[model samples]
Target: MSYISGARKVRVMARYDVIVVGAGIIGAAVSYYSAKKGLKVALVDKKYPASGASGACNGGLSYFGKSGKLLQDAYDSLILYRELAKELDYPIEICQDELFVQLATTEEEIAELEKNVEECKRFGLDAEMVSKSTLHSLIPGLSNKPIGGAIAQGGLHGFVNPFTVIYGYLDKVKKLEGTIIPNWEVVGILTSGRKVKGVVNKKEEALYAPVVVISSGFETAYLLQSLNLTLNIMPNRGVVLVTEKAPWKLKKKLMGANFGSTGQNVSLCIEQTLEGNLLIGSSQEIGVLIREPNIDLIARIANNALSFYPSLGKVNIIRAFTGVRPHREEGPFLGEIKEYEGLFVASGHGGMGITLAPWTGRTVALMIAS
Candidate 1:
């Protein structure tokens, strides 16, 4: 037990086997699974659950958009999510059969979409080329500028309410007897001679544990910096626009074929939420970490949405918000630090944090449990 004394009273903090930093989807998953394996766990966050990228993303489980090792990881995560949806009491809308439409405006883009579809199929994914007429039949209000497109259907792709998923994980973690500590900003990792100790929060409270996992999204960089470790993680700001509830015209998620095209400075991805509101987003701006909504980027997003669905012009934008995603030029880092024993890192997921959270959590938990 850890104790604190003051002029008025003394308090004791519960001891834990493992301490998970960040209560977002990843951390929640780590806590839930770790506790499920009979490990005493403590989950700490600067803010409440889903206050980070997990809550801010568009909530797309784009299984079709991924390839290679990332795709394999996504497939494993999808399987885990499927089981969790049924196991959790929370109302998580896991639409596994949802269709994914990648719009193409030019013949060159159409060719690229076809190649992408073939590539997805090569990776054992269910994908096909959809003609313009077939695309219209799928999404009626879509702008007719595109000659053709590609579609991924069946169990290939889907989406979920990110907040609901995070809550579900946290609820399960609690049910497994895990402790949650919120409003505590972790300032440094506690260590002695390269072996992990625990963490020191802003209040200078030393929460000691044998294993410590840093899953604090972009903020992981700063915490590691204090320990003389540098992560290639950088902040990538993305803005999203939510529209007022309207008649849902989309039966599936939609995005430009070039949205997944490499080397693009910005891209547009749209999807209708279960609440009947359409989410228009997002732009990849490097180094802008401020959460303030940018009107200029919002306008661009609106214009891009309008270009795809003219009917979006009739929708009233309810609000605009932004989130900072931890990005690495190489991809996510998901293993123990070589120089430090009992310390692990699981951030730098960028925009795919939601999609990859389950696997990341399981991997990190297994690492600690073993």
Candidate 2:
């Protein structure tokens, strides 16, 4: 894009206080928070926002899914989201309707659900166990196969639409006069000696920025190669199946405790979107590049959903797609790098990227300020 300056047309050079690579939820959040801080920020992505996991998520904002610092970060992000919803121009379908329900058809799964409830309660969340009858009562069409279940009740543990969340952040960033550059892939980091300057795009265009935050999942490693930095984040594929609009309204975001029991890394997560379609997901295939829907894996995911709600047997699958979850052997690595000046890192969030996003962005922004 060029503009007229006095006599000749001048090419509009992109420059910023912070150039955030990867316009996924993490990068979007970082751009939102940084721009909110009155900084010139640019949110650049190879594709559009939420084109990754954010587009293919169940959008369960819960603290019980993780332990240790991860759990705390999830809780903190939930609180931050409450404040964020008011700031964003779009509605991300933030509803305070039902609890996060985990059902157990077997004794072992029931035991696991009980343990999860205990962990939630220990973290000061409102949680409890329910018998088989109570579980059925909570979900009228639910199968009687479940021996019991657990519930975590509170404002922080509701469900949301991931697309809106990502766009919400991006929208606010643009409203704040921050640049949203799409289809611009950062092939390498621009550097001069000890201090980093900007980023080099695939078109060989150099966008200048004093500071850079690499929040792109899996691809972060490729950008870090030139800087001699390493963040061990790998790809784990998950297939999400979309069923036809539901004939009934689902009250809770359901999880089958038999998740990943097949040892094929498939999970039993079933939820109804506000659009009335049921999103059934997923499987964990590590280090695989294939995004094609595996027929067998898709069948397993569908069968798992049917196991929970037998009534859904006739529900035709309208869509099925695979999403790559970021996998890290150790844990997610965050904060600014000491070796590279003005270069920060945020990746390896695995399947919990959306869950951990707000806290990660807030923390990373604070790091940039410091």
What's the C-alpha lDDT at position 263 in model 1?
A: 53
RMSD of 1: 3.4
Q: Candidate 1 — number of clashing residue pairs?
A: 0
* TM-score for predicted model 2 compared with the true structure: 0.90
Give the Cα-based TM-score of candidate 1 against the true structure: 0.92
**What overall lDDT goes with each candidate model?**
0.81, 0.79
Pick the lDDT winner: 1
lDDT of 1 at 208: 74
- Span of 10 residues, lowest total lDDT, candidate 2: 3-12
Clash pairs for candidate 2: none
List per-candidate RMSD values in Å. 3.4, 4.6
Tell how far residue 270 is off in model 2, in angstroms.
0.6
Candidate 2 deviant stretches above 4 angstroms: 1-12, 258-264
